[model samples]
Target chain A: MAIRYPNGRSYVGREPNKKPNRQKELTYSNRGMTLEEDLNETNLYYLEKAIAVIHKKPTPVQIVQVDYPKRSAAVIKEAYFKQASTTDYNGVYRGRYIDFEAKETKNKTSFPLSNFHAHQIEHMRQVLKQDGIAFVILRFSLTDEIYLLDALHLLYFYNQKDETRKSIRKSDIEKIGHSIKIGYHPRIDYLHIVDAVYFSDKL
Target chain B: MAIRYPNGRSYVGREPNKKPNRQKELTYSNRGMTLEEDLNETNLYYLEKAIAVIHKKPTPVQIVQVDYPKRSAAVIKEAYFKQASTTDYNGVYRGRYIDFEAKETKNKTSFPLSNFHAHQIEHMRQVLKQDGIAFVILRFSLTDEIYLLDALHLLYFYNQKDETRKSIRKSDIEKIGHSIKIGYHPRIDYLHIVDAVYFSDKL
Candidate 1:
């Protein structure tokens, strides 16, 4: 039997290839949520509860052509998604500037440094230099473990990246990074870890 | 006589309508640049000078459909520009979180409150609560004058908006707001005014 597709007509006896099981694993673990979606939901929960105000910046795009059919709406006809020069998220929390990049990897042993762009590292370095709280939120999808690793420690490994392995070991992360306990309400309550790690003097 | 248009067919009688003298006036004043353009150029200048790190967040768009014709590029087939809940620009300045909205008006007498959305006012209020430096850069387009109005004064007016006038008078802005000197480089050096107004203690 042949199945028809939306964009074309189908011939008899030709079966569409079934894709690999990308959905099954994610459906089984972490309630089928990506780290970015989870963080967005968590940020919303925080915002609603008035606990903190943080937002993921929108994906940058280079708009080429736009058609304004009406005064109110603009239709982007030609646009390309551009690489962001800065981190994914930034906002003010507890009167302190909070800046961080979030990344998720399936690797069990180490977080690959390839996940970060050099510009992001430079941005974090600049933030740290200005006394702003800068860090990386690393999520191990295999273990569902999340860690907030300060930029200073990340910089140390980044500078020695040429000589050393291009990844930070999970053991090192567990030692230097602060583990955020996953919760029900705000799934990943990272601010608790931020308080303990960055504002330890006040705490 | 016939005129050939770029889109093709030649027209015999229809004369191309000339747009009003809007372009002429702008060309004569401030080198024909709008306030937003001026600020964006100023931001780039500041970034190049290593004076402060500030960036206008990309306009948020709700992408409904995208086509992946090739592996390298994705074409946005259908998208709508989304209303941003937060202010237009934000970043770290002197280790302080700077959050502000910039607006320009052709009105010479007053700046209308309608230029700002309710959510933007709320966002600024939240920033203020968290001790972030929150303000608005109001530009009187006709006079080519800009003023940095603090969030405190904004909040006061916002709270009494229902009972008060819908617009803030130019005299009021000049009295309560710090005037930013238009400059050759970094066209609107509002940060200089910020240092004077907010960080006066440090100065």
Candidate 2:
């Protein structure tokens, strides 16, 4: 299986000079719903209900070729991701900067530490320094389980990656990270956790 | 010709009960460098030169599908655009919030007023109300010329759109928009216009 880049064209975080027509390798996906589709629908539901405002950041693409035969629309020919993004989603919720990275794992026992990068961990650290709310949404696709782990917990293991060289056990996630109950409206009820952790303090 | 959607999927700004896996009609695009790429390269150059802190807002996308086969990586299956964004680029420059949009047109006669969206115009209006500097960058790809048009100028014509079904003419852009010179470090020297518009008053 190959990694299917979420974006279109030859995107590699910087200017990519070529058009990659070759289909990249992709592994089998049996999670039923795509991570994006579910989250989008959930956000819409949340927006209608006016619970919170969290949005997935768009991939920074560099458009190289656009053919606009007419004045109505333009199609991209080649583009690349500007650079490795620091985080996936960020927005204002309850007057706090909420940042998060969502990932699904087929493994039933553990989630791999390699799913995250070092720089991403560093970026999360800065957000924490600014008193921002940061967490990672982990899904055990096999068991249909989801957990919201604070960025601090993820950072701890990330820093110890060289020493431990072990994946974060699923049991540890269930014990330490807050479990978010899936709902009909947002699908992932992450704000309940946010309200409990950050807003609760204000009270 | 139809509107060229960047990805193969349909644009889903609003929530849809069900999505069909159908290919959208092909639209023609004049392959050219996007205002984003130039600005990103320019931002990097500026950062390296210690000039300013400007970056394109990451595109917000909703991810729904994920395939984590062996636990090492997760791949996105389906996703959609979150919504119309607020602005293209924003950052701090010389202790001021700088925000603007970047657009390109092959048409040499006039940049169409349709190129600007209603929400974007409203967003800029709000930014200006809050005392943030707001503007748009128009690149005439055919002529390879770019202009930094202030929000005040854009809002003037934007408000007039309902009254006039016509666009702002090239002559008008030339008259009102600030012409930006391309440079090696930052391709588009937009900050120069910022200095002239915002800082010069202090001087």
Candidate 3:
């Protein structure tokens, strides 16, 4: 079966002719999963464990035409992708609203500002102003390193883009952001970082 | 112009030949707007005023085929609607997470359980378990009455569907739910009721 991720990436199963080697297959699958897929698995783990309730919002689409056939499901004939105005993932965590955007960069030195939209940054600002916990999950894919950077630092860097470098240096992220270790059960264990960053006082 | 609401309802503009009277047009427009449209406007109002940051999640779609035409946007050729696993709307309100499903019933006496899905009720349970606020915004279309009923009450009625009636009587909702008054600026001012119900002590 062909499965499509919310980000429009198609999940192609293993080739039918390939020899089923469990060890190699496991490693290949883990390496093949994208940042979004990792987060989706992590969120599912949270949900199943009754820890948190975060979900990646569906990709916004501008549905132009839909055909309804008798006694059958409506088929979308034409549609276009719509830019999202808010962060991708959001939900309740420990009685507080948690919102964040996740982006993976192949760049080793810095994460580019082009990964974010101005409206999304504005949305994060609004979330923070409303006392919601806002942040971004940055993944340096080449090194498999992920960091949870608070929206405060993100907003500051975003505003200084014109004056400063157009991207946030990896060194700066290491200094300010919380490192999240990738785990087996929950691929990206980000909530642990969220706990330390936002609920340290309570802890 | 033809505009489509997230709920799949298409908005047809006034006929070009009709005389446009300001007062009559205003009333006609308001009456024509669905509960979803009213909530969208209300959420936009809240966002603009810095009151809350609520949003309706996009309608989930499963894309089967796409055509990548040269030098233009990718066109979704074939797709089908996917059942939503969560509520229609959610966001931060006064530092707390708020989530809810909205539905309008033409029946004047009761709201049917068929309006909800099992996973949605399960999702609400998870949200409430995380200490987030959950509720349903129900509209009685016949009388144009709106109510914000807490998830506790809704869950109770939903669970009793098999034993008792498959619907919650309007009288019972009036007794348990908070009535939301429709206004000019924000069509349905639900946050005011949320303040009284959830944040009364803080108020």
CA lDDT of each prediction against the hidden true structure: 0.85, 0.69, 0.92
- Worst 10-residue lDDT window for candidate 3 chain A reads A21-30
Evaluated on chain B only, what are the TM-scores of all the candidate structures, in order?
0.84, 0.79, 0.86
Candidate 3 structure lDDT: 0.92
Worst 10 residues of 3 chain B by lDDT: B21-30
After superposing candidate 3 on the true structure, give the runs of residues whose Cα lies further than 4 Å from its correct spot. A1-30, B1-30
Q: DockQ values for all predictions?
A: 0.46, 0.07, 0.70
> Which parts of model 1 have CA positions greater than 4 angstroms off?
A1-28, A70-72, B1-30, B162-164
lDDT of 3 by residue, B1-203 (tens): 67898988786666653654554454533367899999999999999999999999999999999999999999999999999999999999889999999999999899998999999999999999999999999999767899999999999998887856799999999999999988888989999999999999987
Residue B47 of candidate 2: its Cα lDDT? 55
User: What does candidate 1's lDDT look like per residue over B1-203, in tens digits?
Assistant: 67898979887553543333555544425467888899999988877776777788898988887778866799887788888989988888888898999999999899888888888998898888878999999988877888999988987776666656788989999999999888778789999999899889987
Give me the overall lDDT of model 2: 0.69
lDDT (tens digit, per residue) of candidate 2 on B132-197:
678999988776788988999989887778655467788888998889886655667788887887
Ranked by TM-score, the better of candidates 1 and 2 is 1
What tens-digit string does per-residue lDDT give for candidate 2 at A1-203?
Answer: 34447674453554452233121112113335766666777766655565544556577555445456575434444444455546776555544556788888889999998888776786576567646677898888766678989999999878778756667999899899988776556667778887887778687
